[model samples]
Target: MNIHQVSVNYAPEQDRLLIRINGKEGGELRAWLTRRLALALLPVLNQSATAQMTKLAGPAAPAASLDEQRDQLLDTFQKEALLRTGDFKTPYEDRQGQPANAVLGPEPLLLTEVKVTLMSSGQLRLQMLEKLPGSDTVRNFQVMMDGQLTNGLLHLLHQSLNASQWLEPVAPANLTPAGSSEVPELAIEPAKPRYLN
Candidate 1:
């Protein structure tokens, strides 16, 4: 959809984000974006040794704490997305890959302007500037017969987006040694066909 305006306000104290749209509310857009952001930030967060150290020193430390933290982070992130939309019916999957269809109804109003702001407290704010339109921007919705089919498409999209970083020349070890002594010769076989008299 044609985005008319975009603004993002950050509220560092809240550790959340808000997103708004002006024209026709984009279905699953918020989830898609939150997933994107989480994917982008998760590695950095996980790699933060200082954060890990602090958590280790915190109260009630347990062996599963790290995993718990990851779950909490993801939950918080999705919650932030929900808050931004204000239309709660958005579908989101939990850490266990279970679908949580908490909210229901028509999608939120779409706006021409999409604003995203990350507050200092790590909160994100999204604002959408919408305008009335004669025609609907988003027209089609299809349910995939299999969940894996949808997942496969998402995986392909993710791979395409991340492919740049993983693109490297094949290592020498991965290639056949040019001067190696062993070489196999191709075998040729003749086939004969008989015609009935």
Candidate 2:
């Protein structure tokens, strides 16, 4: 099944999920849910504050407590920043134009891991690990031409694309036409550098 539409929005604190599909065949709701779940999980995997704290704290302190505190702080900051930015709807409303027959399905095709890297040039690189039925693969995407960092989530969405080259398709041929029912085993490793202008 060809992925005619893909929409992903993620905040570090509150969970925001949204997806829409359209085509001759009625779209699968699970596909959208999976994308949302994957996007939501991105912050956790990409979090740098936690990593920085770990490096600073070393292996002696109670790592668990520090991790918990880090999560709490991250959540609070994310929420507050989102509110201040005022870009997203407080209560997310599903966008109009989704097919009527779309069914809400369970979440399984979601990415097991997502790593986001912020570069000096204000671009955000996203590396996603999606697990299908048998094998896993890493997909790389980028958000570029960013505005001031305060825009937070909205800024990322504004510049979102799946490829380093602005006009190229995000997923390669091997990863294209995201399967509706078939699940494959996927793994994510450190991705190569993708420049954003």
Candidate 1: tens digits of C-alpha lDDT, residues 1-197: 33222222222343223222222222332222233353453344233322332332334333467888887666655643432342223333222222122241233333344343333333233333334468644322212111222222233334433542223454433333588866555555798898999
Give the TM-score of each candidate. Answer: 0.19, 0.28
lDDT of 2 by residue, 136-163 (tens): 5533222221222223433344344231
Q: What C-alpha root-mean-square deviation, in Å, does candidate 1 show against the real structure?
A: 20.5
Each prediction's Cα lDDT score?
0.34, 0.40
Q: Which ten residues in a row have the lowest lDDT in candidate 1?
A: 141-150
Please identify model 2 stretches exceeding 4 Å from their true place. 1-84, 89-109, 136-151, 154-197
Candidate with maximal lDDT: 2
